[model samples]
Target: MWQIILKRENEISLSRQLFYAMKDMILEGQIRSGEALPSSRGLAKDMSISRSTVNEAYDMLETEGYIVTHQGAPTRVKEGLYLEKHQKHHEEALFPVITLADKPYKVDFKTGQPDVSLFPRYVWNQMMYKSFEQLSDKDLGYFGTAGYESLRVEISHWLFRKRGLSAKPQDIFITSGTTQALSILVTMLSKAGLPFAVEDPCHRGLLEVIENSGNSILGISVDQEGMKTALLEAHDFSAVYVTPSHQFPLGSILTAERRIELIRLARQKKFYIIEDDYDSEFRYVGASVTPLYSMDKEQVLYTGSFSKTLYPALRIGFVILPPKLHSEWMYLRKHLDVQNPIVEQAALAEFLNQRKLDKYIQQISRMYEKKRKALTTSIYECFGEQCSILGDETGLHLVLKIPGAHFDEFFIEKCQNAGIRVFPIEHYCISKGNHMDQLMLGYGHLKVEEIQKSVSRLYNLIMDTE
Candidate 1:
């Protein structure tokens, strides 16, 4: 009898273990093709298992075409079933997974980080409880891929009041976050196979989504007013992605003239504009910058996220899609995770209805403004006239530009080695060498004292490097 071991105490059934053992032996050529397997009754007697268990395992092997059974003869291994055994490495993992705790930086200026401590968790919990209590049987099942109607309506209202953008509840499709929205949009729009256009120095993670789809990317450089729209006239694109509200890394608002120009070109050239309204709400300056979506709702796909406003784990965002594109968007979204969870959507709806989010934004904006001021002040104190801050008027982060200073990979590594985590603007650039003298500093999650101390440490590191 072939050597067969069974562990009755194991959670796996005896039959499964036997099947796996036999299959391995067959593949490893220990049991050659056309070789006869022992009869079920005899194998069961040898292994001390029930006759039925052996039959079940044999049945599986037969059904899978790994073995063939004839009514009057023994089960025989199928032809071409044998596979050479490959050597297994027993070495320990060379690269251990690094987590947030691994690289303990004295100060980290990671961008797009929000001060989660300022979020009203108790209020949100109460809302969540209410949403759960009110859930109907229908709510637990697949709600529409478009998302909860109540949440959409509330979002519509919030958009109108805050951004002055009038969007119908039907047009607003709820997503897990802006990242999901971008991924789906990239797929939907890139069907034409035309190159996708994005800011040269754009959000790296979002850029990867488009790049991963195997679509050609056109990197349009950005100036103080935003994307260099003049360069766009030369090429045909499937879509153009821009952060008009608050340009990432550089922190420049796309001027009204450029916004109009983009809309015009999108209309003439027949390309969709992706407006990522990142960090648009917490403007420290005069007023929150109007979204490019407001200018041309039909031409622009507007995306917004509550991840920075609330907590990262909350994972709620939305896109205001045009009506003509809705059916296709829904089809793509249905195949990609169907829809978001109902409880969070319902809870967020209630939160919006009660004006809690509006109040929270107002409260948090004040605190963020203070942190921004402190960060700028500290930078001035440390680097003096050599360094100038950009994009402090809006967003949780700003760019620090030092003329004649190259914040390349070596500098970034050196800073990290010195217990500081600061990101250079060039890190996010699609086409490098354009922005080599700047660094992005996120102060939203840091306390005033932490900001000051981090700036001092950053200055010391820079001075040492110089």
Candidate 2:
């Protein structure tokens, strides 16, 4: 009799467990090739299981070619299936343990996280449920890579009404977010062995996309007006990446003269300008600045994201491409990720069509305005004219320039040990020593009480270091 045991009350079927155990033993070479298996009746009697269960397990093993049986003969293990045991040494392999959730911080000043508490979850859930109930069988199947057509049409109308930019639905290419849009663009547009020009101290993630793609980068300087286009005369580039509406980290609006100059340079040099109009909808000033795309549609690839205005988990963004690049972009997108989920796209289309996005942005804009005011006042009270704030007119975060103070790695560690979290401006720069005297503070996610306490703690940390 075979040494087979069966637990009849196990959650897994007895036949499945028996088949797995026998298969594993054969694969591991514990059961030698050509070894005869016991008969179902004998094994069943030894294991105290029904004869039918043992027969089913043996049937599976025979079906899988693990064992061979002839008419009225015993089952024998198949030969030549043993794999040599060459154990791989993973001693040199390094696995990263750091994750976003594991990041240690007390007063987190992380940027780009919207206040989730203010999100209209009830309305969003209703729309989502409605979309699911109304979805056709066609929606569940593989849609086109460009996106759901209804969403594209709705987005076109939304863009025209909100930003005054006339974008056709055919020209719009949907992506997961601004990051993926930029990533795909870098792959598609970058010329072989050519350098790209990017604004110095740009969003580090975007800059990384260019660098990791092996495209040489020309770091054009920027002042209060954004990306000094005068410096472009010296170097040739494949394209220029810019944040025109509201510059990243620095928050300087590109001037009209510079916008014209940039377009002229792009045409003269035969390169494109990537206009990242992120967070333009939340402008706290007079009117939303006209995107650089307005000056020349053909030369600019405009990208916009809903992460800031809407919840980040929405994972929706779009790129408005000119007619010439449209075909290539579509091809690249089809091969990369196939397409976004249809359910979210369908729901978002309904949301945009009903003008829910418009009302949502208006409500959140007022909340952010109040938060911005609270942060500004708190900083003034804590530092008392010793520190100056930069780029407070718009966006979720601002830079605090402490005169004669250098916030380096040493200072950052000390602040962390004291439970204060802030980013040094130098952390985002490609060239060191340029912005060592400033710290970046994100107040969008902080409440009035939390802002006051965090600012006071940060101010005290600076004083103690000095």
C-alpha lDDT values of all predictions: 0.90, 0.86
Clashes of each: 0, 0
* Per-residue lDDT over 154-228 for candidate 2, one digit per residue giving the tens place of the 0 to 100 score: 999998888898888998989999999998889887887788888877888988898898888878877789989
Best by lDDT: 1
lDDT of 1 by residue, 81-114 (tens): 8886544442225445567664777898887789
Off by over 4 Å in 1: 1-9, 33-80, 85-102, 118-126, 129-133, 191-194, 231-236
Q: Assess every candidate by TM-score.
A: 0.85, 0.93
Question: Whose TM-score is greatest here?
Answer: 2
After superposition of all CA atoms, the RMSD between model 1 and the true structure is: 3.7
lDDT of 1 at 199: 92
RMSD of each: 3.7, 2.3
User: Which pairs of residues clash in candidate 1, taking residues 3 or more apart in a chain or in different chains?
Assistant: none
- Candidate 2: RMSD to truth: 2.3
Cand. 2 TM to true fold: 0.93
